[model samples]
Target: MERFYRRDFINTLSGVRNAHLLGTLSYKKVPNLGLFNSVTHIGATPPHLGFIMRPLTVPRQTYHNIKAQGHFTLNQVTLGTYQQAHQASAKYEVDEPEFEAVGLTPYFSETHRAPYVAESPIQIGLELAEEHHIKANGALFIVGKVVEIRLQSHLIADDGHIRMDAAQAVGVAGLDHYYRPEPIAQLPYPRPGQEDKILKPKNN
Candidate 1:
């Protein structure tokens, strides 16, 4: 396979991925935002999240800021902010903050030094916990502990699952294609000798 084609094929093979806007702040207080599809839930006991970052062959402001500042924000991309979120991935000058260039509002709170996207429906503030550098590729595996979460009260369910459909959260396929997911059904926990039943979809 050709180089570009191989890259695209491997990226999309994992199916749809949650699109997130990662916000960080430089030591100089310059807010930076970047679009990422690699965010993954690591654990719940201590509330940890991990994301894969590209190899730092060049200056990666997000990585630099997170390492230097020790905090970052993970904001869910919504339909309204998907375009701007994608645009945030562009390479900009070290002094030029992506938040200003992409036209997204940068929000800050007393609890965190990093900025969050004001347009994002679900915002998570995290404190840098650990970072692992892959030997084969210089990619960094960043782990952060959740410090704060902000979202609409109605978007969460009693079971703790966020109603993503109601939030209009967007997902990415391959690199550029975006999609909105619909909830199909919610099923009960599996038990021994339990009969299989078709669960009804939630009313959105």
Candidate 2:
């Protein structure tokens, strides 16, 4: 396959992925926003999450800021803000923050220096926990422990599951395409000999 063809084809193989606007702050106090679809759940007990970054062959403002400040924010890109979130992926000067350029408001909490997207319904602040460089590809895997979560109280179910569909959160396929997910009835946590049982439908 051709270079661009191969890249585009392989990128979508994982299907639609959660898209977030990762917020960071440079050492000089410049706030930055970048759209990232590589964010992944690392664990639940300690509340850890991670995202992948490309190789350092080029300057990655997001990676640099996260390392310098040791903290960052992940703001869910909702249907209302998906266009602006996609615009954040554009290359901008180090001093030029994407929040301002893309017409999104940068919100700061009293405790964390990293800015969060005011328009995002679900925002999470995280502290750097670990980082690993992939030997084969030179990409970086950055892990963060959840520090703070901000969202509407009504979005959470009694069982602790978040109703992302209610939030209208958007997903990304390949690199540029965006999608909003619909809830297909939630299934019961499978148990031995309970395969036939299904939970009552709820917002998922």
Candidate 3:
């Protein structure tokens, strides 16, 4: 059976990709960045990632940053830096540096030519590859090609999986609530009658 919810169902979903995207302002000059909870990994083979821009919204700092640099870093938002992430999202004057506002440090990227939040534990370098507009809701859909991902050495699990439990990254339910994640399964999304195998690790 198919299921459906109000178009605003996203506002009710409990877990979402809330990240701190860092980039420099092209039009305004000073540092421009923001916290975006709408990011996702699109494809793994060629490493495509995606994020959305809510429609009718005036141009955003991070949007201008991407336009200026053609690159941005998706900093894994953490509890320690959630405050900074939230602070960075404020609509500050285009010329004002959000990092300066929060006293956070910016690290220059060697790969993508964009800056990332130095305080973040992990980050992904990305370059814009595709963009489309969501017609019904008027949202802007963007796909970024992953250039590189920086991660701490120990976050790797014994099976070589990203030990997200150790990463301490935080997610948002909507606009206000934030929480750490718990893993239920890794891969091989299961079908009915596959429950027993689903619970077992194929890698073993």
Candidate 4:
């Protein structure tokens, strides 16, 4: 495949991915925000999350800031803020903070120095735990331990599942496209003997 075609095809082939706004602060205390779709949960026991970042060949401010401060934020992108979130991806000068350039509000708390998106429905504070260099593509895999989470109370379900639809979280189809997801159905936990029983629809 051609370079442009291959890039788009490979990205969209993974289906919808959670879109997030990564917030970091430079050593000079400049706030930065970048849009990313590669964020994923790594573990639940210690509450870890990881994201893929482009190589350091160029000045990747996000990578630099995280390394300097050892803290960052992952803010969920929502329909209301998707456009502004996408705009944050634009390559800006080191002195230009995306939060200010893209017109998103930067929020700070006493516990973390990295700013969070005030518009985001869910904001997570993460402390840098580890970083691995991917030799194949020269990408960096950054892992962070979840330190704080801020969200609306109603979005949490009784079973502990977050109602993403209620939060209006948006997903990315590829590098540029954003989408909102709808819930189809909920399933019960699976077990050998309970497979058939669990498959049955619950009576409202």
Candidate 5:
């Protein structure tokens, strides 16, 4: 294991998806949006996920969109969509619509009116459930119940895992470093005497 400490890595390690953060504004009010480095999964049994959005200290678009529409989509961005993902993160003026500015397509979630990235490989429509205020950084942690989920057919795996590497999943480190998939250890991750099989497989 490598050991070095310069600063507590500025990562949004909170459990959530690291996808392109998608949000919807209004009927006549287009949403002011940006991408997030912090996102993750929360539950599987009940099927839920959330994003840690900043508070209303300076008028948060995601928070306001959630409050007004009660809906938002967390879109997972990957290498295939890297250009738009980085382009959308620019802090645009309040009056401009990010989708319009960046030329990204928006899809109305069937489960709710909130919009999602049409070009994204995976998108989840969420209804706001809870807002946790983390005052230290003025970040409002958002919890949403999963009402809908959309994904490209090729990304789903038979083992019930989203082949993240093949999906080209990206991760953010510190303030601005972005990371794509990297090769790690191979599968069959068990050592001798560490097997948990109580019964042997019988060829019938």
Candidate 6:
């Protein structure tokens, strides 16, 4: 397969993933926002999250800023903001902040140095906890401990599960294609001898 086709095929092979705008601030206080689809839950006890950074052969401003400032924000992309979130991925100069260039509002909290996307329905603030360098590839794995989460109180269910469908969070396939996810079913924890209990979507 050709390079571009191979890239797209491999990227989209895993199907759709929740997308987010990662917010960082350079040492000079320049705010940066970049769309990312790699965020993953690391742990619950420690309340940790992680994301992968591409190979460092080229300049990676987000990695630099996270290292320099030791904090960052992950803002979930939604139906109304996916376009601007996607635009944040464009290559911008070091001094040029993507928040302004992409037309997203940036706000800050008193405790964290990183900026947050005001338009995002779910925003998470984290401090750099650990980093692992992949030897096979030059990619970096960044781990952060949750510092704060800002969002509407109602989006979370009584059991603490966040309702992504209610948030209208956007998902991405490959690099550019976006999608909306709808809840289909809710299932109880599997027990070997017990009959499965399931709740189907109301719309279904």
lDDT of 1 at 112: 81
Q: Compared with the true structure, what per-residue lDDT tens digits does model 4 show for residues 67-143?
A: 88899999999999999998888888885867877789999988988999999989999999999999998998999
lDDT of 5 at 204: 54
The C-alpha stretches of model 1 lying farther than 4 A from their native spots are 195-204
Clashing residue pairs in candidate 5 are 16-39, 16-40, 16-41, 17-39, 17-40, 20-77
TM-score of each: 0.93, 0.93, 0.82, 0.93, 0.78, 0.93
lDDT (C-alpha) at residue 136 in model 2: 95
Give per-residue CA lDDT, model 6, range 1-204, as digits (tens). 999999999999989989999999888888998788989998999799998899999999999999888999999999999998888898988869688788899999888789999998899999999999999988889999999999999999999999999999999998999999989777677888664344455676
Cα miss at 148, model 5 (Å)?
0.7
Model 3 TM-score is 0.82
> What is candidate 3's lDDT per residue for 1-204, written digit by digit as tens?
223444346575645655555555455446567777878768899999888877846867677668666887788888788877887777787668678798777787665577777888888888888889998988888888988888888998887777766888888766767778888766775578876664455687
Per-residue alpha-carbon lDDT of candidate 5 for residues 1-204, written as tens digits (9 for 90 to 100): 233333324243432335565767764668555687666679997987766776676766666667877888878778777667778877776657888777778787545678888877788888888888897977788888988889877887886778778777786664456777675644665578867743575675
Who is ahead in TM-score, 3 or 6? 6
lDDT for 69 (candidate 4)? 89
Better of 3 and 5 by TM-score: 3
lDDT of 2 by residue, 1-204 (tens): 999999999999999998999999888888899889989999999999999889999999998899888999999999899988888899999869678889999999998889999999999999999999999999989999999999999999898888989899999999987888899777667789985575565777
User: What is candidate 3's CA lDDT for residue 56?
Assistant: 49
Evaluate model 2: give its TM-score. Answer: 0.93
> In angstroms, how far off is 41's CA in candidate 2?
1.3
Clash pairs for candidate 6:
none
lDDT of 2 at 79: 88
Superposed on all Cα atoms, the candidates' RMSDs to the truth, in angstroms, are 3.4, 3.4, 5.5, 3.1, 6.8, 2.9
**Candidate number with the higher lDDT (1 or 5):** 1
